[model samples]
Target: MTEHDDDRPRQPGRTVARSDPGRAMAFSDAVIAIVITVLVLDLRPPDTEPGGLLAGLLDEWPTYLAYAASYVYLAVIWLNHKAAFTRIREMDIGLQWANLGILATLALVPWPTAVIANTARTGNLADERVAVALYAIIGALLCLSWLVFFSYLARHPDLTHDHVDDDYFAHERPRALIGVLLYLAAGAAGVFIHPLVASVIFLVLPVFYGITSHGYDQGPSFLRRGAGSAKSS
Candidate 1:
């Protein structure tokens, strides 16, 4: 009688499951959308007299600034999240939890955003410091979540496809470290100095990450490889 493979404790070279990781991405995207929608809903209309619409809008620059900053932050997170998942071929329970951690941090963004807007409008440096500190804390948590997720993926190569090599981790791990350090520094600045400094730091990060991310190359290379295969066939 022929022996079945189920007798083994673990397969010597088990292939990653064929299920696409799109469902996770879709769920993440939906959550992100809802979070952003909630953020916009938090924006209160400026209290003004009749025929003062333009002046009212101009007077509420703080609200606009906070909204723009938070919006950009969310966009950057989504971009990096999409980039990371594109390289993944499979998922595990740990990865799912990491994703949830990130989402939880993101869900907290609206509160700080509202705080900053309210304090900015009031021109109270003391309250502004508190607001900035809160925002920076959230930003730090978000960066830490990303760091954890990347480190987890790097430590577990089996969760990813074959194209990802040691080089990928060597590159990504340091990148995550840099992000964490930068966020910490910004948080400190927010607590010690003017909040504007921290806001500038937060705004600058996406530009840095955009330029330096290894994730940018990962997605297109797969497309190139597939195109080459089609031509060869």
Candidate 2:
């Protein structure tokens, strides 16, 4: 038998099955696009009764900051999602359910984002802590959903591209778990320490995950390879 990820004996009735991911991928893209659009729509121009345009804008820094950070977060998710699908050759019912779970978690991002911005804007420390805590939990759950998704993919090599090994997503699991833990920590910091600290953690997470989204040092592995080729050429 050729060496790959198929060394494991196939389970009865669980033999490899395949289906096109096109429709599902398209749906995912549409949903993610809508979420991003909604995030921006949540922003509003600051009231300008006494303050001028610049001051009004400045006063709404929390809103701008929230939008900026959330945009980057979604961008990272999109990038990683694109990478994951690129390595997936087919889809199964299990994969479809996992994907839906992930998307469901993602769809909820705008709520906490809006809460954080609105609370911070109001200068209400209690509300800010609550908002940050909510954000942290949501972020953690999203990370956990990714863990489930990856774990499912790891076990279901029949759904993966030929180039991917069984251990590929297994290795990725740790990174996802790290995200989960850090998010919980951020939430704790918000509740016990200070919301500003949690905000910093929120800003930092996307950078970490984005860089190692493919379980590598520099972003998605395939994209890095493509970039390396273009540079060498």
Say which candidate scores most in TM-score: 2
lDDT of 2 by residue, 121-229 (tens): 7899999999999999999999999999999998877677667766677767777898899999999999999998999999999998788765552567775575456
- Model 1 steric clash pairs: none
For every model shown, what is its TM-score relative to the native structure? 0.81, 0.87
**Candidate 1, 43-78: lDDT as tens digits:** 778888999988988989888888888887787788
Query: For each candidate, what is the lDDT?
Result: 0.75, 0.85
State the RMSD for candidate 2. 6.1
CA error at residue 9 for candidate 2, angstroms: 9.2
Q: What is the lDDT of residue 69 in candidate 1?
A: 82
